[model samples]
Target: MNLTDATLILLLAERIHGTDEGVREAAKSVVKKIPRGKRDLIYNVINSPSPLELVRHVAQNLDT
Candidate 1:
């Protein structure tokens, strides 16, 4: 399945806090690679009480 960059980042965030050490590290690596602009979007998406509709849609479908 193809996921947008934002969706992939959100999924990585979920994995970062997961029990698997290797997966967490890999997720962190990818997260760190996210550019500054995208990082802002990520922060907003994670912290906002009401993020944009598209972000919300992607977040809802993310596999936790």
Candidate 2:
């Protein structure tokens, strides 16, 4: 995925957990590119499941 989408995913992951400083920084780098209205969407996508589940979900989507 592109940097914007990747950043969103990283943000989502970081929000779910307190670790992953690198991912958080990456998310910060692209945070401005994300639209304000879409914050909830990113949160929802990230918080919908556990991190492992989220990883699997992303992997599944990418497989298609």
Candidate 3:
């Protein structure tokens, strides 16, 4: 996935699991790799999805 999509996934995982220093750092790393202007887009995508869906999606992805 692109940086924006990756950031959204990380952010969603973090939100579902609650904030953690590691997760925040990881998300920051992803954001840093992208253009500053795109940060909001990542944030918007992360916040747009439901937490349950995020968790379920992650779990499903992992099972594969």
C-alpha lDDT score of every prediction, in listed order: 0.48, 0.51, 0.54
Q: What's the ranking of the predictions by lDDT, best on top?
A: 3, 2, 1
Clashing pairs in 1: none
Which is better, 1 or 2, measured by lDDT? 2
TM-score of each: 0.32, 0.37, 0.37
| Tens-digit per-residue lDDT, 1-64, candidate 1 | 1125645655555445443343333334544566655555455454454334435465686576
lDDT of 2 by residue, 1-64 (tens): 4545864566466556645444444444554566776555345444454444444455467537
**Counting only residues 3 or more apart in sequence or on different chains, how many pairs clash (N, Cα, C under 3 Å) in candidate 1?**
0
Error of 3 at 34 (Å): 0.8
Off by over 4 Å in 2: 1-4, 7-19, 41-64
Tens digit of lDDT per residue, candidate 3, span 1-64? 4754764667565666664444444555565667766677445434544534443455467647
In lDDT terms, which candidate is top?
3
What's the CA error at residue 12 for candidate 1, in Å? 8.9
